[model samples]
Target chain A: MTSPVLTVENLAKRFPTGRSGVFVNAVNGVDLTIAPGETLGMVGESGSGKSTIGRAVLRLTEPTEGKIIFDGRDITKIPEGQMRPLRRDMQMVFQDPWSALNPRMRIGDLIAEPMKLHLGLSKSERENKTVDLANRVHLRPEFLRRHSSDLSGGQLQRVCIARAIATNPKLIVLDEPTSSLDLSVRAEILDLLNEIREQTHAAMLFISHDLGTVKLISDRIVVLYLGSVVESARTDELFSNPAHPYSQSLLSAHLPADPAAKLERHVLKGEIPSPINLPSGCTFRTRCPVAKDFCEHEVPKPHHIGSAEHQANCLRIPDGGNRIAQTETA
Target chain B: MSLLEVENLRTHFISRDIDNQIRVAKALNDVSFRLEAGKVLGFVGETGAGKSLTAQSICGLLRPPARIVGGSVLFDGQDLIEMPQEELNALRGDQIAMVVQNPRTSLDPLTRIGDQLVRIHQAHTGGPVTASRGRALDMMQAVGIPDPANRSNAWPHELSGGMAQRVLIAMALMNNPKLLIADEPTTGLDVTVQAQILDLMKGLTERFGMAMIIITHDLGIVAHYSDEIAVMFAGTIVESGPVREVFAKPDHPYTRSLIASTPEKLQIGGGAKLGGQPPDLYNLPSGCPLRTRCTFAEDVCATPPTRKQIGGGHYSVCHFSGALPEGGGPQ
Candidate 1:
């Protein structure tokens, strides 16, 4: 088997609250791997710590605990100076494209900054490559001269993608890249990302709250609840037969684009609990439809469902009680 | 009879630019639609397409720098456009109700949840506070807020996002509004909570016999919840028709592109043209709003095109609406 491009083990992050010495346990123990050129989608609602995981994986936010191995190197506690050289192989595209980029810098310099800093490319070479990157990401060469405020959301996102791919990074973490753009423009961006995946063969950690968009691009899926991985499986398998109660509820909640499609909505009982004071055992128990007394006392371990690759963290899996019934009948 | 009939609604943002010159943005031009009671009409558009502006225009919620300069919003027998300030104020929270995105902001942080509900009823009907309180409790239960009697006293900040939205819906229902405008109602809620809220809305529209206009950019929510769909571009209804007809056979280029772009229908490498340049309200190009991005655009497109009806209430605002290429296939 080929070595994975990224591996995260026992990943956790605790954010310190003001003066109280109390912490918001944003992420719990999470383990996952992304192979070279593989797209792993991480889906969760707000406060699910999915975004925290993405940032922590890149060391943009320091991980309180866990190990993040990039390209077969354990860089968990690596110094900022040492990580600066390693930054060339890892890039991130932020959610709000407008705020992600520097407003003062022209698009040309924004896209060229990475290449210049990492590869030590000359001004002439960087200029030529900036145009090449722009064309590759479907951004017109003329817009490169404009500031971010002067461009549209889709165009600005393309510039963000251009910057991310400029250094030929091995891993790119996109945090809700398309969530901020319009629907039609989102499709165009997804198409561009798909094309780049083929050409660059970069492993992507596509983190989004929208399941439909994730299903469109991801090879595998990981569902998170209160920062812990509840289920991880092949995209097709997970969609067709989700083994976790949370996964089942999430899949059912997704409103399909087609009007005629029958929706069996399993609207969960309550809002997601606050992350500041998470649930004791199963963080999802408070909202899980089939949660029992045992669920409150036990942190269900990942149990292999049909195959080893498809696993769900639910004790009800063995008893066939994992699936939640469709309440919103057609 | 249609509960709400909006005709040639022209709303503009009359503002001054950074340079201090007066800039008039034609935000909504010739927007028209007829909605019957108990039916849901979904408005699908990108940002700045003026979905919320149209709602504001209909509800008389427009503030200075933005005004309804043309057309009429006739609700039932009376023309809302010409209505007096007092009459419009009385009608707003009663017959015409609006629930916007971010329920927390729409709610009064100072008032208790129950009082907020009762206050809407009292504001419109002017009944005894006791009667209003009784109705408020009933509405709290009606909108699916648990323990209506106790939850009534809960502070607005204490309620979760889903609970807050339900409270907003309950507040809208207190006066038994004839028309409800939910602008991006379930946007910020969790996916699961969104479904619950949408289902609640659907049931409420039927039970109360209200005409609902759901203004949202999510095609998925619109597809399932709405009976009719209006596709807006550059602040105009580019295409509109029954949901089934529009989804099955999109006529306008913009609508076609919209449906083709859905994750369910999009072909990965098909390279469907994304939206064109952002709508420039200040200096809109003459002719169709979508002309800038349309692949079928020609010299004839230089002339503004009127809405052409294909069949079954299906209408497209383009010279060659039905003749455009059918969307969604591996090309």
Candidate 2:
């Protein structure tokens, strides 16, 4: 097996709320490893710390605990000066392309900026590669001289993708890259990302709240609740037989676009509790349909479900009570 | 008679540019649909497709610069378009309630949630204060807000996204409205919370026999929650029909592309007929608004296409509606 490109062990991030000693626990004890050319999708709702994990892995946001090893390098505590060269091997694509790009910069300059900084290339060489990158992302060469403000949302995102791939980084973290895009445009973006992944062989940490989109691109999947990962498995296995109660409920809640598909809905009651004051033990216990008394005190450890690669953090998995009964409504 | 019938609706944004030239955006053109009591109709489209504009026009919610140039919105046998402002104001919140997107911004920041609910009821029904308060609490309970008595005192800022959405739904239900128009109600909400809210709204509609028009960009929401679906493109409803029939056999090219773009059906690099620019509202094409982006555009597309009925009340506004080639699915 090829060596993993990125490995995160017990990653956690907390932000001070200005009230001394009060902090927002954004990510808590997340462990993941993404092999080269693999796409690991992270799914969660708002405040689930999916975005924080993506940012922390790139060292964009400092993790309060744990370690991030990229390409066998322990640069978690590396200073900015030392991290500059390493930045060439890590890239990130944000959610909103309109805000992610500089409006004043020409699209050609923006895509070429990464190459100019990382690669020792002349201006003409960089310009040629910029045009080549534009063609790869399916952007018309004429759009190169235009500003971001002149382009549509879909076009702006294509520019962002071109910039992210300019460096040919070893790892790329995408945070809901297609959430703001329209449906047809979203499919186009996903297709482009898949093609880039195959060509560049870059390990990707794909973060999104949309399960269907995640299922389309990811080879492996991780489900997060509050800040911790509740389950992680192979894509097909996770969708077919999710062991964690939260994963099951989440899959059940997703409304497929097809009207003919049977809907086995487990409409969970109540809202996700405030992340500031997380629930004791299992963070999802407050809303878990099959939560027990022990779930309030004991933090369930990850138990392998079908294989060593398929694991879930739920106490009920051992007793065969993890599955929530879904009502066949429609 | 249907609870609401909108016929040949047309809304335009007439404004002057810096050069002082009159520029009119044909935002909603010939929009028409009907809803019976206890039924749900979904308006699905991409941005700038005017799904929300149709709702705003039917409810008489258009502001300055945006006027209903031509249309007749009939609610319970009365024309809402011809109705006086004062009369429309009285009927709006009482019989025709609206829930917009952004639950936090829609609510009053300074007022407690319960008081806001009470105020809406009083404004519509002019009931006694005590009676209004009782109705507010009942509404909160109906929307499944936990501990209505305690949570009612909580301010809007204190509520979560899902909670705030529930409060908004409760406010819409305070007067037992006959028609509810929800515009992108669950756009920013979590999937689990979205299911809960959709179930709550669907249950409320059935219980009160209220007709609902749910406008959203998510086709999944329309497929399951709405009985009928209207596929809008460039301010016009390109297709309208029963949800099952439309999904089974979409006649419009744009509708086919949308359905094929879904993750379940999409084939990456398989020539899945996706990607197009939204029509320019200010300078729309002469006939088919989607001609500029349509893959199968022809010279004949320059002329306006007439609506063609494709059995079981399913209709498509395209010249080649029934004769279009098969294979919208990913190759």
The prediction achieving the highest TM-score against the true structure is: 2
Cα shift from native, residue A145, model 1 (Å): 2.2
lDDT of 2 by residue, A1-330 (tens): 887999999999999999998889999999999999899999999989999999999899999999999999987999999999999899999999999998889999999999999997999999999999999999999999999988999999999889899998999999999999999899899999988988999889999999999999999999999899999999999999999989998999998999999999888878888778988988888888899898999898999998889999998888888889767998
Docking class of 2: high
Residue B289, model 1: lDDT of: 68
Worst 10 residues of 2 chain A by lDDT: A267-276
Please give, for residues A117-173, the per-residue lDDT of candidate 1 as tens digits. 999998999999999999999888998888999998889999999999999999999
Model 1 clashing residue pairs (backbone):
none
Query: Tens digit of lDDT per residue, candidate 1, span B1-331?
Result: 5889999999998988899999999999999999998899999988899999999998888999899899988899789999999999989889888889999999999999888888888777886899999999998889888888999999999999899999998999888998999999999988989988998999999898998999999999999999999999888999999999998888887787788888888888775565567668999989876777777888889899998999799999999867766663212
List, for all models, the DockQ compared with the true complex: 0.80, 0.84
The parts of candidate 1 lying over 4 Å away from their true place are: A19-21, B16-22, B328-331
- Indicate the worst ten consecutive residues by lDDT in candidate 1 chain A: A321-330
Tell me chain A's TM-score in each of the predictions.
0.98, 0.99
Reference-based lDDT, residue B191, model 2: 98
